[model samples]
Target: RIDAETRRILLLELQVRPGIAALQSEQLVAKAFKTKVNMLRSLGSRVVMTVLEEVLPAAAREAFRKATSSSGAAGAGRGVRPAASTAAPEPMPVAPEEHALAARPPPAAAPPNAPQPAAAPHAE
Candidate 1:
């Protein structure tokens, strides 16, 4: 256990100056903001959460929303999963001649004697 703690401490020590020369400005900002977050966490104030939300990407925000929904921690931002069909689909157009045929339900399985597509001129 002491060895494991020492390794963890060394890992954090190595990352102490993270993003000092990152190509992107966001990487540097994220690292700096993390230090402030640690301070806020230690002080036990949740006000920083609002600030944290501002830094998260849209994809991460969406994943967090989904996770919150599944974890039953939902409230104001309840993570209700979207319904399969929230909007009714528009009905497809059917040819006048095929209206009667379309009105009938389709067969569950094709009979071996069913007409092949090659036998129908309008199959296409």
Candidate 2:
């Protein structure tokens, strides 16, 4: 039998940090409480129904129900398409000279000891 006190604690923890749904579902709740997937599923459904039906106002519950129903209907009509199946095109072959040219870096400047070209004469 599930412990009411432990269930309330787990539900409160899940509500306090909504982003922890994955951890709550996959590991924490099950590991800590020694519960199985079916139990977790039933507990989650009951928790959700309690919040939606008992905690929420009548107007809010109706709106939420309508939204959920609409989204379910919309999802039924949609189908996911497989990714494009085309193979990648082969790379173009580079010419030998082009490859050699691309591999070489620009030549470095001559050393200071090396003779320099004479500068053009300036007008007075």
CA-lDDT, candidates in order: 0.58, 0.66
Put down candidate 2 lDDT per residue, 16-122, tens digits, no spaces.
35666675554666564665545545555445656679789999988976765587756642333345669988899999999999999999989989998999999
RMSD of each: 16.4, 17.8
Candidate 2 stretches with Cα past 4 Å from truth are: 1-47, 74-124
TM-score of every model versus the real structure: 0.24, 0.24
The alpha-carbon lDDT assigned to residue 44 of candidate 1 equals 37
* lDDT score at residue 92, model 2, on the 0-100 scale: 100
RMSD of model 2 against the true structure: 17.8
The residue ranges of model 1 lying beyond 4 angstroms of the native Cα positions read 1-10, 14-49, 73-124
- What global local distance difference test value does model 1 have? 0.58
- Candidate 2 lDDT: 0.66
